[model samples]
Target: MRIPNLWVNVFIIFVLPNLSNGQQLSTKPLKLTDGQNGVKSIPYRATDQCMPKMDAKRGKTTYGLSFRLHSKGGHCDDGLLICYPGMLNRHADSLGFKVKGLFQIDNKKDNKVNQFCSFKMQKEGISAGQTHWRGIKVYTMPNGTENRQTMLEASVASRPYKLGTNVGQFSIHLGGNGTDLLTMITVNDGKAFIDNQANLQKQFLEQFWNGAFLREHTGLWMLGLDLLPSMKQENVKLFIARNCNCTMETWFTQPTDSSDPKEPELPTAGSNNCSIEFESTSEATTNKNDVSDECFGEKHFEIRFKNIFKKCWMKFANACPNQTELIMLTMSRRNGFENRMGIRQTWMNDSVPGEVIRFLIADAEDGEANDVQQKLEEEQAKHGDLVFLHGFVDIYAHLHLKVYGGFKWQQSFCANANWVLKVDDDALVHLRRLAYWTGKKFRPIVAQNPLVFFGKLYHKYLPIRNPKSKWYASKEMYPKDMYPDFMQGTVYLTTPATINAILLHSGQIDAFYLEDVVYTGILAELANVTLSDQKKHFKWRFDHFDEKNGECEDGVPTPFSIWGAEKLNVFEHQYGRMKSIECKK
Candidate 1:
């Protein structure tokens, strides 16, 4: 998953025809080596002044190719080809070689080119109806051979024939054995196109391999062909003139002991860029309307909350003298008095000694109901656990600020606690079980390694684009189709150190609509915090809970530490039933 810095360079030679002015072509081949952990990269450069001039009207396209090899034998079993337009300079000339090849499979009867090699353009962004490109293909081995093959490809229509610039940029990505011959072509338009016209090709070759060293005498070499523009017709010449740059990275894994031929290949999730479509959307496009005035204000958000928590801790120390081992912070709406009371009567009261529970409420926005603020103040006076954020508004769009405020509060006030469990007021939490897991089971791990986050996790989930959906995220808001690995928002667990890291580095990240994606995905990634999927800790639906089947009769479900019980009756029923059941030794 991670690439290393050391690399081996390999050289590629380009042969250019002599012009009327009599410039000799270079015959020496450029030599470069490959990198370790199955990675090969080559930078683009121009041999002479013959580099392509940037096109003013049409922008340049950048291409990437990734190759992955699973087994030890010298063959390319898996790969991907990616293309992005308008990513590079059009006029600059560089040094690189172009690659052209047929996707072939070795059949016992005959070796033939696969019909699936034809490239198709992929649609970008989250949308209602779009064609899904099958960018990955697997070919089973013929008769006696044990090896299988996989190939991925994508291409675009070439630009129209221009007088000055011929080729803009090209690169090759190769994986597996260096000797597994592939068809390659070389073309030179001469120094006239290079010097006055600023026309030359730029190409890069990157290769990734399995962990072991490949044999030197492997047979995979690219077959090279020469091209001349003068001999070809205008239409055919235009097609050949388009630039190609690709990144080829191959994942090489050790062989498995299973001998069944029908066994499925290992899942390659993040191996290629072909999985997600690239659009021209920027970060500012999606975040334009979502930016709050609170973000720009001079108030130190973290410092203000730190001061508030210090005062609350003093009050808590006088009321309850026991040192709290776990702090549970619930996100509450200022108007949701019923939900807060329902939580307090049921699960909030179930916490054993050495555990603390509290609600985080924010002020109502300007021009809204004044009665909600009056009720929150009364509730804070009655229940000493309420921590109110002063300047922030209690709204769905501003949830990131509220959550960050909670993290800062925990880090400042409850820094001695081993774990901080964040849950919503609508959810049902098995606090006794959570306390046992965090304190008795997971405490040693946190003491040694403190940057751990545990919760129900979402991986590679595409953003919802439907306007009617509650979680609609426009392309302008989030350009990528898939979000990074993030914890589910309903209930998740973290440590004091991770909370501090998120608070310290959170200024660098722009707040998005989804607090889970913003805090756990984006900010956590920037902070280098480790995320873990607690499969049994969080459940999306409570439909499976049946008292007859001892689901609620026992302490929650086997893996479910928290359930999304939005209704008060559902929370009370489950909590009452779980309480009646006896605990096993």
Candidate 2:
């Protein structure tokens, strides 16, 4: 059965003098608003610095090309290459810098005359995560005569390289992604160059984002190479993503000078000259390590800042039959009657006595052709599990309200429940396994005031600036490049105290449409909520793209306590497998 939602937001603005451990909370009430952050979203205004990239119109189209490097006895004898791979600027601004996607310069005195050659190959239009090989070109000075000449160039790999002396050529990459231009490789001879300094890496990265090197509001990538002179050769790589905020990691052979060959320090992922609230994550003490980071590839270590939250959720559980130990608040649409019925007959029915499940729906999301509200009332009369919320339109953008409202609802009424689970109506929750894990894992921690916030963590992520994206965030809304680590909002678990912390903190910051990012990430950081980081224990119940691809073979029962956001038929099938004694976990 479900609880009704004719409830008002309760705010205890007074200071708590009798707080546990003599601790006091002086906090305000959560007042969520859609901060009129979209005045110029039509023609967005950017108040922050932007990155520079290749200016197509500002830079002339060269008529020629060349690539010549001198290698002797398996060692590079000459070549000096400096390639700044940047975005292909479509803007006609005078501040833009002209760069050929491919170029080569002969700095070698052995080449007689100091020759500078530059040209364009193909228009830069590659996408992120794709590596391509194209025939590149550049116009060179030829001999000492500065007339004009064209010479074609070559690339060892997709990466741009420079050997030594005046014997080298420059190579650049162009990408379809705004923030990502190309994957550039710079090979240094291990000298006293500015690029070798760790701080320079940060500066170049800064120039890449701020308008210092490009036009305002632009976000692009910059690559700097600082190699140790001692190492014969090393291969370092970085993969850029859509938001240009992927975790940077690599494995390389030690440079020759082992003493000072430290990993090059990079600017915090997605961070630039500007500051946002809690822009960088302070590390949190978790009992588990990140099992999810494997997706980023091999890394010796990852930088984690300190984020220590005060442990709060305490022992308040007794095995009383009527005592509701867990509250599963499923966010549902007002007209999602079919989904509700599907869940009721599936995982929702797999509940034990101490668990309570309710579907939360916004009042505004109801019927045109059908009387959704009346049918919901009838459904409530039959099931008694629907909680209707007021005061917000149920559009996709305002979905974050579902989180904030649902959490507010949880804290106000179900504070006594040992744990609170938030799930989507499309999600799958293995109540039986959750019940087992509660006793085996979660209960003990809850007994001692668990510092638990469980869900899959999206570690190094950047907010998208492209207006075409549904998740687009403007500078007025979220000016920061990186969002604090947030969970995939499909499902998450927390205790009453954590919810209180989040709610209070939510009152302190401006709200955004992306609820998981604002509440789960932004508020979660301020609340100091550390993730459970048990990724293998929680996952996505992947469905095949084609249902026709599915066979009538024996179904596999999922062992996870939660794996979610599934379709109706898949939910019913999985639920059947969960009940069948013949299925293996």
Candidate 3:
């Protein structure tokens, strides 16, 4: 089912409660000018004092109050905790919050998130004294007001939080049965953990205030995490709010905001400047599974690459095991730091594809710039070989491609290839099978519905979540009911000539964030190339299907792509066992 996009907000409140030894004293609430000397504070012993109607109805053993700061001006230019009648809590040493899941928040929207602050409180009981409020310090704001936002009705339950070692340990894993969002974090003085509802409302509210918004709104976005154990904290204090001007264009309609009513609608299908077809070797290579294109150039460039590589390899005095080479290139210097290390080690190892050649154009010769150069140079010397270009020469869209422009760097290296496969560093390649499969054919392996697996299928998004996700391409951005079958840029294959054509044609195409989707899917759409899916390219849940015919969960593993390394290792062990038995024959 095709899911529609929607919007939501998030907030993160970390509270530290110290009610150990004995009951503590309640600190005097800071006076506000709303016609009150001191604010009426709710003690920790009170049950259901703060009602935050959470999407998830789960919590802990004990309960307490914590108050999240609502910046008076809608934006938190000044760090202050203006108290209202919510739960009271304190911010731990590591005062940073992180959000991760199927939902993504754009950190670029608003920068005021860096200035907001909050407080921590412990639960009150019959035996628990007012002294319990001692460790709970009340931090006053320098320049902020209290009545900015309202507290929502939510769930009630308390659990111990680990504020020291496990304070910053935060992770959110999405995808599960029904619509439940689950979270697990370390708590209880490092002795145990708690699985409860992670204030997703608060998460979205923070994102909303910071200018980050959600995209899909059909299903509910769930969060599961273990609380940091230290004080008695409740789930009801969680809430989300946004002060930025809301816009449909900012959420899902447009890439950038504009008042032009004549603005073009999002393209559902068609090719653009960023799309191209690589050399396919033969008409059959391009015709596999009904994938066809006129702009791709009917002339297959496979033989030309084989002919060129035959000479280059011979000249270099190096020979690939079966004349199959995996040519990899990196364009941006920033990507070299963000993901290159993991990419090279996980996907470029010898057991996967034959060889992975990394090409970089060093912009500077010294300083930290040189350090990046030095690090990459050292990595190449240690892991494999590096190709360094002297200065600024734009072979591809260096500025726009960011992390996805690596394939554009393979132009000169196209000579040594039976097939050329382009993939991003973040993708975990299944090298062995990919190499073996590419050796058997020259046609591209595309998906029937690209990004669908990550969208409505395996990892689906709900409508109430943040609407500012990158995946929410509207009709103005895409025109078709669904994406044409195209190779995921994370991993796509072509003939050597096709690679060269793509390299040359890449100039006509403007660079995009996810280059693979832009080129193989969007660009191919315009070029009239029919994208076909190689069923084994993606993974389905084991229980979601009835049988496992040695399909390796998703499909065959390519040494160049990312697969579950542990699972792959287990398979390799089993393969070794089977191979030994076959050798006995």
Candidate 4:
């Protein structure tokens, strides 16, 4: 099943009860006015009160009150609570009616019957006499000064509970059958005021209110809540409000606001630059089972390369008991016979005693390219060095598939090799110097590091957009502004473990046209492999080969691997100049 690209938002709400250690419900009518508008707010009265002390085991308890508000003729605005710190032993009448607006009571549904008020202490450095109170008020105007019965008020004073630790941050972890949720809250130096409804539904509500202190930290809190089992398959919405200095600064509801920075930003529908087109012919449909079995089965190929390698091992067992330390995988085309021969005559023949070289080719499509397929089969039969990926097409766009198959082949047959170098058939390699460098310089690092990937590195490269260009990549193919760090495809080196990692992560990434970008850049990033720059070891174009110059100094420490070197004479000249020079230690 295709995964949908969606964004999610999450919030963390902390509820701190009043330090007086109790709850309260009041019905006495209290008048409040908006300082900005200078108009009387909603008519609400506190009905009940409870001041439960903080528990010794539990660090802090809550104090709250319930309210009964008179229904107005028109719609009622939301309620607000202004808190006064260090107001212990001061009743509502003795407090002198001066309170800083701290908490907001959001009556989004506009329910008119009852409202709740609660407050918690967030200040850590408060003295023993220092107490806090919540002055409750609503946002509705009085109804033409109508005379009504006085609202009944009740206040219950309970025994104080022991106070708990007053830390700056608190965290809670909830684990279920599936994913776990972590919630945390932190305040600077002042007290935190929480509402009564938040206290009641502390397990379910995920909201946060502005605290007393600011300016030091970002007030940044993170919460991860697991979705209900029933809601796991459905979309979820979250509301977020950022209030600055007791005023709502921003209120937004979005589907994709997550507090986790590590969460990968998926491509949204609006930002999707690539579209997938799937074409299935009758031949492909008929061979669907076979293809699936070949690709995903226990064996990844119909014709395995291990048998040929085993035969070669038996033939060379007397001469060399140990397997080759390095294997050069030269990607070749089905019809590039002369290019393969030129490579064999040049660097392939110049390989040291323990090193091995092989060519990789894929089978042609059904009912086409029969001549090229026949020639490939003949070449494979004669040399046994051609690793043919049966039931796969040899196309430029499917180079990733070829490389994947090669990785599987190496894992199966040449698992003991220290390093695997991939190059093109048209390129010439200075294998001797490469061998020297790998043995003398790179071996110690590779011995301690198995995840090292080395080649000519490219970073922040834009995709080719011209349709006529050979490397043109449409926006639909790649949407990012720059490709991830990747080694150039022409020449790159990987160890057995790195190859395994690349193969393991290949399925997680979308298949792209460029093999290097897909495998080395995308899959390598996912696999977390280390990529090193090897520009000194490989060059793209060898148009300027000067033996008298530093290019060939000390036996050409850098291998001259050039593109468009299909001519045998070019390889002969290049190899003749490079063969005699040995890298000076």
Candidate with best lDDT: 4
TM-scores for all predictions: 0.44, 0.42, 0.33, 0.45
Estimate the lDDT of model 2.
0.41
Residue runs of model 2 more than 4 Å from their true location after superposition = 1-322, 365-367, 446-449, 543-558, 561-568, 577-585
Q: After superposition, how far is residue 319 of candidate 2 from its true place, in Å?
A: 19
Name the regions of candidate 3 deviating beyond 4 angstroms: 1-324, 329-347, 351-354, 359-374, 381-405, 441-467, 474-482, 502-511, 526-530, 537-549, 552-585
lDDT of each: 0.43, 0.41, 0.29, 0.43
lDDT at residue 573 of model 1 (Cα atoms): 80
Q: Give the per-residue lDDT digits (tens) of candidate 3, residues 1-585.
A: 212221211122222233233333323222121121122333331111112112222222112222222211221111112222112112222223333332432221222221111111110111212211111111211111111122111111122222222121111122122122232222222222333234544454455545543322111122211122212432212211111110001010110112111211421111121112332222122222322221111111111111011000100111223454666443334334435555444444434455555544332311122245446544544443333332122223222232222333344334565445554434444456555665443233322321121111111222121236544434333334555444544445544444433444443443333345555654554544444445454332223322222334234332223322233443343234322221111
> How far in Å is the alpha carbon of 6 misplaced in model 4?
60
Q: What residue runs in model 1 are displaced by over 4 Å at the alpha carbon?
A: 1-322, 547-560, 578-585
lDDT string for model 4 (1-585, tens) is 311210112111111211222333322222121122111222211111112223344233221111122122111112222222211122211323221122212121221111122211121122213222222222222121222111111011111111122221111111111111222222223233222322322322222232321111111111122111111112212111111111111111111112111211321110011111221112112232232322111133321221111001100001111567887777888788988889888888877766777777764431243356557545654555676554334677557666766676667667778788888888877776787777765777778877878889998888887867767777666667789999899888888889887766654555655888887898789888888887877777766655444344444446545555777887787677655544544
**Poorest 10 consecutive residues by lDDT, candidate 2:** 6-15
How displaced is residue 133 in candidate 3, in Å?
Answer: 45
Ranking by TM-score: 4, 1, 2, 3
The lDDT, on a scale of 0 to 1, for candidate 3 is: 0.29
* Residue 390, model 3, lDDT: 23
